[model samples]
Target: MKKFQPQPGFVVQAYKFALDPNAGQGAALRSHCGAARTAYNWAVGWVTASWWQRRAEETYGIGADELTQWRPWSLPALRKAFNEAKHTDPRFAGWWAENSKEAYSTGLANAAAAFDNYAKSKNGRRKGRRMGMPRFKSKRKARLACRFTTGVIRIEAAARHVTLPRLGIIRIHEPARGLLDRVQAQAARILSATVRHERGRWFVSFQTEVKREIRRVTRPDTAVGIDLGVKTLAVMADSTGEIREVPNPRHLDSALKLLRLASRTVSRRQGPDRRTGQKASKRWEKANAHRNRVHHRVANLRADALHKLTTAVAAEYGTVVIEDLNVAGMLRNRCLARQIADAGFGEIRRQLTYKTRQNGCRIVTADRWFPSSKTCSGCGAVKAKLPLHVRTYECDACGLVLDRDDNAARNLAALAAAAATGTGVAGDQGTLKRVSKPRGADQKTRATRPRRKAGTGRAGGAILPHQRQTETRDRTQAEALTLW
Candidate 1:
């Protein structure tokens, strides 16, 4: 398949709006999502059947040459086999035609991608964590979503409704004049629409290729470094020596009491039990929905805050410098996980990435081990150790006392300056060289073996073997432990 390449001056974007479908339309939407799930499950079962058959045959001492042929999981293969069997297959025989064909294709496409990922991971061709074989999705746990790439997908002239394949016109909760005007002016072309059921509401996202006009930042020659933390959402230090802090709203923490109360109320009601074949009482469903609403509100608030913060920063600065934080590793700290997650560190970086592009600003990511907080902004001296508990950075060399986050943000800003000047800053000697990992480099750990000689100690004299073999935790581990 050919990869999609947007035309010059055009970028792909998604415009999502909450749907306010009536009862009949809601049911139809559910049907389409159900059709997608059904198709996915069927594909999984059909492909894995041959695997089970081959395994059983081998156990019976059957020769490899006589084993059943393996099933293909490519989209075209799955579609061809599904079409041949849909008429006779009891699973989809009667109601397969109720929803648009795109519903089934979405599932098949997903299954194919899942299988491909599994294959790549197993062969060590994929990055990140390993993947397992595709499994059947449970009706109770699976997300409800369906994508339509064809058949009259459009925003109605009223800008208050959208039309999808087979589902016809459905009302939306908010006006879509932004997207409608663009579409009417031919500045954006809708490529597909995806309907998803989330947070007890239906939403449709239109994927489009939009010709965006990139605007210059307010301060075209300025650079700003952002230091993300739990106490403060972000501490930004600009090249002009202006420092600002965006306070953490702590939305989740503030709503914890309400969430706890709602959860306790839900526990008192008779909830569903799959093993017992008991359905939830209406009171239980209502209580559960209330709890979900609390979560939804928190999520919405966080997203809104992050978007506003990122947009402002991206629009004001010509260059934005952010740390390449190991957020996954940071989450492993039990004490700060909830607070860190609530701060939306990863989400902030993701939004800034695209937002900066649209604002015609450059974003520079500092190396994960850049030691931003440990580096002093006054004399450019890098500290050997700066514990998290020490919120005030006291520079040993220059006697400069400053807030820890403020110092870090200033140090980060210096990195951008160094890049622009093509000269190494005091604390960023090897930063450019270390930005990208060398080919075939092993993943780094937060610990290191002491570099002492087999019988030597810190004084460089002979020492015991046991003492020589003592392991040393890097600054990363020390900081992690301090945070914990």
Candidate 2:
């Protein structure tokens, strides 16, 4: 991303270039990633073995300097140590040592960083529980090539596609138009480029430190509040009362049949049992890979959709308002997990957060309990309860019957002004909506049902109601339905 300091304007722009590495380059990059993985595993084993021998369960005993002497954690250190113990250490030999220096560096960096993070957390300098020594990532995990740094990593102008320290130059999939053109004209210097293979494809993301251009907005006074949901995706309520819908991509349905077929194939193939220390057959591995491919495809589809939605929203809105969703809490509800994940509600908000800031826009977060859903967007009257099935908000006071998501979006927009001017509590969003009145008569409503939250369980069963419902539904639809 380029920042314009000289002109002092509120605009910044950045580009991500896709890499097209050759087969050899791909192999080399994989080699480094593999090497890094090996080194990481080796380091973990060494540290664990050392600790076991010392019988010191506490990570405090193994200092960083002491770890440096252990070898296999770093290149320079490992090479020197490797020379001395070429015949002594039975873990690995010449072939492993021939791997990229980056691999060893990765392991050492990972371990050091993990240890430091743990130390900081222990001293209450960071969040999360007190962590222990870094555990080695398994070989089954996908290899990562892109490395993070303070500055944006960019490609060199002369090379167009620069070679990494260990990985060779690979072609860029994209025609590095604006960025490359700008850099070649002495406007920008390409700092670094890293090629990464993720979800069955290779992509090169470039980070360039360049002179930022000043941009003036045509619609200077425009603002919008976005309320995200599982059913509607995103509802944007602008100051001009324009409401837009970005529908959730339920990719699971499209890929489910194929995924099921893959799963069946995997099951048909005799798989290994790790309890018996059995390795998987070639057929099983292939089937598993196919299954993974399906999962990857679904993930890729979701990513593409989110990217487009966020990018468009950022360019349009001057001030964005969104809710601070309790994704973790929502995930705990087994009934809604699938739908919520499909919507990618958290991802939408997350993208908006940085994108708006980058696009010279303001982002306002409504309190979790601000009653965006239950509040009457027309009259500002808050409600106590609104069931998930109730997709229309029927306000008794204002007689406003609107699309549930639209109403929520409008409510979010208004809440932004309130939130900006006042200090609101940061807790569950349930407290905001004091009551929700359905269209039913007051006496008729009171006779059968008492007041309760939308997700409230009327029957506090020893087992959840959804669990019973699921069992019954599964049995009823077992023959008719296919799950993937």
Candidate 3:
């Protein structure tokens, strides 16, 4: 029998470490990160400028290969370009060597990737119609990420030391816990290493290719459906009737006052004037750093919450079902945008999608257009109109009234179950929910509204008993939408 060759798997993870780098060490890392950024920006400018003057003549048009010869796309070519430009251009004079080479490499890598993507799109091989050039990254958003190959990154067994190219030897925050053992066993190979600085701390990340023993199935029969929203990070319903709630972190909201104060301070300071060749005042710079630190803390907190939630769900469920949420589109709604961002709704789904793979769980993505909220969980009675204001779902034909979101969650759970059974319905089934508004509780339906005989709506939503409903009447008193 042929040996079982497990499918290729990857683990791209970042870990926090308590790195107390000396002043010199910290400066060196910063320089390298800056160099990478410079390199990336330089390459983007060069390629774009070069392409600007040229014309597309051939049937195949100008691709990365042809343009690479006429331009600098490879690392060596990019380095050479930066070397010449560093001195001759005057614009970048005395800027090279002082900063890390990684910074320069970043720019080149970005431009190269962009060009390559365009080339793929031009050939009609890429998905979603076509692609665009990778936009250049801004300095304000630049993060320290250094890529080092095998010879550039090495581990010393006896001393537990790391020897980076040019940077020389350094100590790891923690011992390479059994890393060498795995390497010796031929289970892992170091592909690349990156050192980053964030939250006033430094960390080294290794991108390795590892061969692992087959992961056995633990709970193949278990499946789950996860519904993500702003009020709660997620309302997960599983085959076992368990509904897990991961509350929103709202990190930004907590730091809002601090952020506002920082912004006010920054505004009052003498900011930099680019045209006048002036750098920001020391005070301004300090204020900026303070603001950034707060932002970083919020991010860290949010990430922690999400990872915990997703990890739990992935480990507990065998087959996970999640709606293909359009987070970007949803963000357009200003009222919910901040809440959604704080909730990290998109991030939760993303984490769940990937973690399930590691936990012997299959992720079933419900279609984006699928109406998991409108349809009745008990019977397939889809409502024609569901408003955002309505907290409860009441099926007229079936006479089922339940919490709107809960009802939706139940429908999603049922849909996931149906799909797993290999017998499922696709597309919208006239599924609609009551138009819910965020307001006072006890939103009993208006008396004027004719109540259809019972047995339509099933499952519950986020209604906490005393939910409100809009009051619409035809008389001269007007449509008073007073909550109950």
Candidate 4:
């Protein structure tokens, strides 16, 4: 029942507000976005051309040291190179100064990060999915976004308008009182502002360093576990033996028909053809907008539901336990991908991770391979195997019958105690344990990939210590030894 202590200094936070711009202002915003895209495309082309030149030179039997050096993709190097070329380069010579310099910097910064990630992935130093080389940003496919950091970015005293570097004062669709109040009280300082065009609307997000008050949970001694699924968005079980279920809203499923109709309408209309130089019809644009609106609505609904659920849990419970689901792997199942995506399993855990930390609550993530669903909550007996079709968990040893999700949630709840003690059992499974703590794992260890033998694929790398040992013996031999 330990309480969280207040941090010594401020924390960086973002405040995003929708914008309402005039026709002329919208045109200017689009111009800046285009400028950013142009700069990013130029950088990619320049770096790629340099690479091809070096490769071609090597093909001519040129010495390795004699070949032209490859151009670096770092931001400083890109900026210096662009500065020298802008005056003579026909592409950017005419109206490059129309937009703020920060626009170009934003693009260059993104390019640098992209190349860095690709290099890291090539060396097997980066985690998650591998990143490819940076490509030219297309006007039609790329998201329109620009960031301003060195210029005057501020909110007006009235909280009705915002001022950017070159964009000038633009009216805000929503009130900005929350951010304005903090700034006026000397509790926050704006660091940067990014303008983005999404779903046919413009939004400005301010990154600020703000002083947040330390929050306390309502029930400091209470602990609860969350079991996330498609049918029941979340099944909760608390230490008090009380269970709660939050029904899935199925926002995407509910709007699937509308989305399909809108998509069909768009497909029927005369859309833009870049190859043939054909412009999109007005009707096509309207239909495409309708389709985008449906998608945006679904995303907003899911985010709202997740926020409400996470807020309630973080504010009330002192310790929250949840399973570490392999969402990416789970989504590979074509049959359940749609339903699983609609459930927002990853989003739920993401929101909870931050909310719990902010509200002074602890989050315990059970190992991904933990057999929560295959263990008896009543007596801790581990089942040999449990299939997804088994909705009800019937324990043979303890004679406990309960809902599958509910039993998993209860087991997750018990993990908090096991985690605290480090050596305790969850149900009857003495060997069931967690690998990481609530905060996170060791950064040094987690950041480095495991070493593998030469000629072995990634799958053949070292396995986790908790995994069941494999042998050449048959199932009968393994069972016989267990009985003895």
Candidate 5:
């Protein structure tokens, strides 16, 4: 696949602002969102019916030539079919013209992407989380959203109001001076706008092609190593031997009491019973909204804290090294899951990645199995076992004691040092690659051996030397087993 190369001086960025829509405008926003959801559900049903028809035909022993071809799930095909049936389809015939055409297009685009992702995942061609087949969206559970691409999406000169295609001039809660100044100065162009209702309030986000100015770090040659944990959000050690520890806010843990109280209040109210077709009472709706607001506040607080932390680090350092943490595996620990998640390890790395590139800085990620915490930073000694309960690292070889996270951070900083000196095998000038562990005459651990040195019969992280030496001498005999 060809890589996407953005224009030299331009970058794509999004600006989101909270909206303060009046009652009528709020209702209109909800209506558009509902229309989008309806369109998505209709598309899903249509595709599912087509699949079932094909399956039924095959079961009836229909000839291959006579069987109906499977209906296409592409956006263009779905749009053509929907447009032809809208005038006669009972579900949409009455209200088809009430909303903008962009609403339907958004739903169709999403449906196409969903089907494509499902196919890729089923065929083992997709990465990350596996996706199931496209499912119908529920009105109550579905998030309210709609996007407008070919519309008059602009910020007013006054910097307090904005104009969308159909939804004209909605007031904003915060001043949009940053985006407005760019638009007025011809430094940015708005390409699309998405409006959504989230956490009991309305927000509009503009996707723009912005001309970004190159940024420089305060300390251009300084490299910092960051170690992330539940107790401390980040433990950073710079090239100057300075260590700074940022404490974890533990937002979720702090709010658990209020959350529990609010949840109890919601439970006491009369909620909707889906099986009995009973609607929720007003008290239930009010209680649910209150609970949602609390959750939203917690999210906002966490995001604000993370942004400040990442921005400062990215702006001050030229090179930042962080661990390639297995956050998914870490979350499996029930005892630390909530605290680890609240620390936002994944989010911090994601932000740092973009921020470093946007500025003229670089980021280096250590390999997952590098064993940073188990190694002694003072004397380059590797320990076979280091339990989580041990907060301080005590080196047996050098008798040097230090904080566990601080030792790891210092080890990560050594990687930067190696890369800077041109001694490490860093593939790219800016990207510091993983290096092999140094060989020691007294080393007994097979897990630390380099890939080339570790013999053929390796499984897991260790290799048994005697078992592998016998197999290498009888290579022809081992190959004969494949014939059977």
Candidate 6:
């Protein structure tokens, strides 16, 4: 398949709107998503059947050349096989034609990607954590979603409706005048549309290639460093010696009482029991929905706050510096995990990344191990350690006292200055510095004891190809830094 390349001066973006479908349309949406799931499951089963058959044949002393042929998992292969069997296959024979083919294609695409990832991970070609074989998705657990890459996909002239492939026109909760105007003016072209059921509501997201006008920052000569934390959401210190703080909203903490009440109500109701094949009562469903509403609202509030904060910072500063925080490791601390997660440290950096690009500004990411808080902003003196309990930073060498967050923010701002001037400042090298790997880091821990080799299984007590272990690389190795 050819990769999509947007025209020069244009970028791909998604515009999402809340959908308000009628009851019949809602059922049709569910049916489409279910069709996708069905297709995905069929693909998995067909491909794995050969593996099971080969294993059985080995037990019977059959040669490898005589084993059952393996089924192809590529999209075209799966589509062709599905087309041939749909009329006779008991699982999908009766109602497979009700939903659009794109729904099934979406599922097949997902399954193929899952298999590809697993293969890459197994062969040591993929990064991050190792992936296991793809498993069947449970109907109750799978998210309801479908994508339309072809056929009619458009935002209506009315600005309050959208037309999707096969789904037809559906009303939306909010006006899409911005996207509609862009399309009418030939400034944007819709590439695809995805409908998803999430957080007790339906949403349609249109992927489009948009021609964006580049804009200058509010303060073109200024650089700001943002120090994110649980107590205060952000402490921003600019190169001009001005400091600002944004307080953490703690949305989840504020709504905990209501959430607890909702949870208790759900617990008292007759919920579904998969083991006993029992369905949930109407009251249980209602209570569960109420609990979900609270969670959804909290998520929405967090997203809105982060977007506003990131946009303001991106628009104001020519250069934004933020730390590469170890959020995954921080979550292991049970006492502060909830608070840290609620702060959205990772999300802030992610939003700033693209926002800065769009605003014609740049972003600098400090090394994760950089001692921003331990290094004194004044006199460039480094402290051995700084405990979390000490909110005030008192530099022993320079007699400079300042708020810990403010001091950290100042140090971060110095990094941007160092990069700009091609000189070290406040102990920060112009380029990112490498540090030794610390114990109890976010990555997989090294084994203390000697590890055993893969053991033989059913066939002649020999280790299978899939069972061989792959070597892991050191992720803390030094690398060149580039501005974003």
Name the regions of candidate 2 deviating beyond 4 angstroms: 1-23, 42-92, 128-132, 146-161, 214-218, 272-289, 419-484
lDDT string for model 4 (399-439, tens) is 99999999999998998887678665343322344445544
lDDT against true structure, model 6: 0.84
Better of 3 and 6 by TM-score: 6
* Cα error, candidate 1, residue 463 (Å): 55
lDDT of 2 by residue, 1-484 (tens): 5542333332234466666777787776677666666655665565446445433433557643344221123334444553454446665565655555545566555654554454344434557556655677876674666443323344556445655554545566656667767666556655544456777777766555566543344454666778777767788888789998877778876788998899999999878896898888999999999898999989989989998998887877666677878887899889888888877878888887777666677677776767888889888788888898988889989898899989988877765455445443322421223234535555455668766653322222122222223332222222111110
Q: Across residues 1-484, which tens digit of lDDT does each residue of candidate 1 receive?
A: 2344456899889999999999999999999999999999999999889878978998999986787766667788899999998899998989999999999999999998887777555545568898887899999899999999989998888999999999999999999999999887778889999999998899999999999999988898999999999999899999999999999999999999999999999999999998999999999999999999999999999999999999899889998899888899999999999999999999999999889888888788887888899988999899998888999999999999999999999999988887777674322322343535543436644454335454332323332222232443122122221121
Q: How many clashes in each candidate?
A: 1, 12, 41, 2, 0, 0
Displacement of residue 467 (Cα, Å) in model 1 is 57
> What lDDT would candidate 5 get against the real structure?
0.82
lDDT of 6 by residue, 392-473 (tens): 9999999999999999999999899777775642223223555356446565645655454534221113333332333211
TM-score of 3: 0.73
Q: What is the lDDT of every predicted structure here?
A: 0.85, 0.63, 0.65, 0.82, 0.82, 0.84
For each of the candidates, the C-alpha root-mean-square deviation to the true structure, in angstroms, is 12.3, 15.4, 17.8, 11.5, 11.1, 8.8
- Compose the digit string of candidate 3's lDDT tens values, residues 17-70: 345467787778777877777667768778666545444423447653454223
Worst window of 10 by summed lDDT in candidate 5: 475-484
Alpha carbon lDDT at 34, candidate 5: 86
Give the per-residue Cα lDDT of candidate 4 at 198. Answer: 86
Candidate closest to the true structure, highest lDDT: 1
Report the Cα lDDT for residue 471, model 2. 39
Candidate 6 Cα errors over 4 Å, as ranges: 1-7, 422-484
Question: Compared with the true structure, what per-residue lDDT tens digits does model 5 show for residues 332-427?
Answer: 999998888888899999999999888989788877787889999888999999999999999999999999999999998888877778776565
